[model samples]
Target chain A: MDVKAEIIAILKDVTGLDDVGSDPAENLFADGVLDSMATVEVLVAMQDKFGIQVPVSEFDRNQWNTVNKMVDRVGELEEA
Target chain B: MHNITPYSSPTYFIYLLLLLSPIMIGLYNGKRFRVYETFATVIILITAFFGGNMSQGISLICYILFEMVLVLSYLRYRTKENSKNNFWVFFWSVILAIIPLVFVKIDPLLNNATISLFAFMGISYLTFKSVEMIMEIRDGAIKEVKPWEFIRFLLFFPTITSGPIDRFRRFQKDVLKVPSREEYVALLKTGTNRLMLGLLYKFIIGYIFGTLLLPKVSVLALSYQHQAPLGLSWWVLAYMYVYSMYLFFDFAGYSLFAVAISNFLGVKTPMNFNKPFKSHNIKDFWNRWHMTLSFWFRDFIYMRLMFFMMKKKLVKNRVTMANLGYLTLFLIMGFWHGETWFYIVYGLFHAGAMITNDAWLRFKKRHKKSIPSNKFTECFAIFLTFNVVCFSFLIFSGFLNTLWFS
Candidate 1:
């Protein structure tokens, strides 16, 4: 799977919501689907899957609130 | 020379308005008068610290110099190419940043003295900003730490004394540019509204509750304490509610002034309270009450610890990890408040509440079909949460210590 699909899958797994990928731009946090704990799980899953280190401080809620943004952030981190 | 505590008196507001006029005009015209703003900030700080509080002024300068060297050095180390990002270096930097606050907090115990050589108004809030910057730099969230911007963020006069605890990135964003005319106008409106509300909350309602009712309730509670079980009487209950209101109005009022002044200055400092009494759970209460501080704790302490534990597979159970996080977060928060027994107990109490709250939430999720959800239930939840928080405040009030001990 591509990075976006993989992230969606991770979000699906963490939130237990299958429709989390319906809108790639949907805010998981604002929608109450992804809370702080769930956000941590998603970050950990990314580390395991993408091999990118996302420091908790670098996790801006606004920037990472959507699946597409998470994908972009992961790509940026990988490049760096 | 007159000492002017931020937002302390009518005269202070008069002086502040006079100083802020030019900045407001600059913002209205889409210009940021950075030099003038910095000059204003210096004037405010001098008035706040250089009169009768001269010693505090000296201490604040030393603290700033110490933190500047530490943060700037850390920034240099982190920005170096091929930097190893040594964990010990980062750890020691945070420790050194917090040492002044630690000395101030513990000074009361060491010499039975109320003041410490390191103590200064807003030391705790300034320490929070410094420690946060170091942590962010380590995390690569903050890539550059300009010296002037760093000092401005640390000593941004309005919220410097007691904070709504603005983050470095957020504050830097505001400081780097001027708001549009429309934005500035809106800010002026909001600032005006908050200033008026602050007056009502702090001077009127807060005075009624704190200056007027709190003393009477305390007296009644104490007078009836000898006859009641566990020294708990109806008067004590009244004292709890009264003190809670006083605490909310006074602090929230102060926060309003800080935010209002910040708005006028085009900084947009975050609001500290949000009708906290309306919260339906302890977690919700935290989100609504003293929000910046709680969010800071959630971000800097709880989230980091949880990540560390999860990363290390420390406890294996997510539930256990979360509970431990709450325990540590609240304990640290408690100690941060002071070394007093009541403060510590207050921290433990909230930690316990959070743990129980999490379990209750889990149970509710499991039994979702069986449980009824409606307005009445929602109201009941709010009522329950309100009383629970007020009781916590009572413990925080240190009356229990007086009632039981001296």
Candidate 2:
């Protein structure tokens, strides 16, 4: 799977929502697909899947609220 | 000399309504009288602090100054490009923020010397807000801090004592805007409704359940427990239900008043309870009950711990990491209630429930086809969750210890 698809899968699995929708720009937190707990699961899944580590201390939901933003964060972490 | 706890009785609302009338009129006219609002806030604070609570009044003043310096200093450090270790700054700031609260909560357990001098009502709520702001600063969620605005947020008196703990950013947004007339109208209607409901819940219903019924059932329950083997009987169950009702009505009623007052002031403070007894599981129960506090825990304690565990590779299994997070989150919460065996066990009991709830949910997901899906099952889930919660409340009430040991 591509990075976007992989990210969506992680969110879907964590939220237990089959239709998380396909808008990468949509706010996952705002749209109610993910809450604080689901967000943790998504971060864990990202780490387990892509070896990308986003430290919780550094995690701000506003910066990483959208799927696109999360993908961007993951990419940045990977590069760092 | 009006000795009043905030919203504790009918008289407080009368005083509150009189004080807030000018602000409400100003808001209805699409203007926020900042000076008047601040004056009213000061009046309420004075009434809360100095109205026969002289020591706590002094403590509140000292605590505010202490936190003001600590937060402003931390904010200054945060803005520096080449600052001291960010971690230690964050660590010390949080510890200092909570030090007064620690003294307040732990003082009762010591019995030797009363550190009540360091104590004031609403210290815990203020500490939660202060620590949250520091963490937000660390994450750059709060990029800038104004000292006066920060003080206003901390001392926002509506939900001061027991909060549906408001966020700094959210509160700041509302504080900076004067809601439109239409919006104020809606807020007035809803606010009145909420306040009336709160009055009904806290005064009437809570009186009936907590004041009237609790003592009777508690007496009977203890008497029966003394005679019964294993100190358990139907009277114990009766105590559990009655105490649960009392707890819900009393606290939820206070939360409603807090939210209602905030709404009247045009802040749209978040709701604290939402049909919590109808929750289908333990996790759902937390989402619905004392929502602000639980969400605070989820964001600050539980999620952070889960991420830390995953990042450090402390546990290989993701589920175990989540479970451990629940335990830590709840144990800390339990400890926060006070230094007591019942409270600790209450926290552990909820942690166990949440873990089992998680496992059951995962299992149900896997066995969806075999599991029945109907109103009966749904009702059964609600019933089970309710009983489990009531049982936890029984532990929390400290009645069990009194019954068995005392």
Winning candidate number (DockQ): 1
Residue-level lDDT tens digits of model 1 in B1-406: 7667798775778889999899889889989888898899888889888878488789989899889999999999999999899999999999999999998998877767755667788999999999999999999899998888788899999998999899999998998888889988999999999999998999899999999999999999999988999899899999999999999999999999999999998889999999999998998889899999998998998888888888889898888988899999999999999999999999999999999998888788668789999999999999999999999999999999988898
**After superposition, candidate 1 runs with Cα above 4 Å error:** A2-5, A15-27, A67-80, B112-115
In terms of lDDT, which candidate is strongest?
1
lDDT of 2 by residue, B216-284 (tens): 988787777757877888889998999899899889899989988998899999899999999988888
Fnat computed for model 2: 0.44
Error of 2 at B142 (Å): 0.8
Interface RMSD of each: 1.0, 3.3
| Chain A TM-score of prediction number 2 | 0.90
TM-score for each of the candidates: 0.95, 0.90
Q: How high is the DockQ of candidate 1?
A: 0.66
Each prediction's number of clashing residue pairs = 0, 0
Q: Where does candidate 2 stray beyond 4 Å?
A: A1-3, A12-38, A44-80, B83-85
lDDT (CA) per prediction = 0.90, 0.86
- Chain B TM-score per candidate, please: 0.98, 0.97
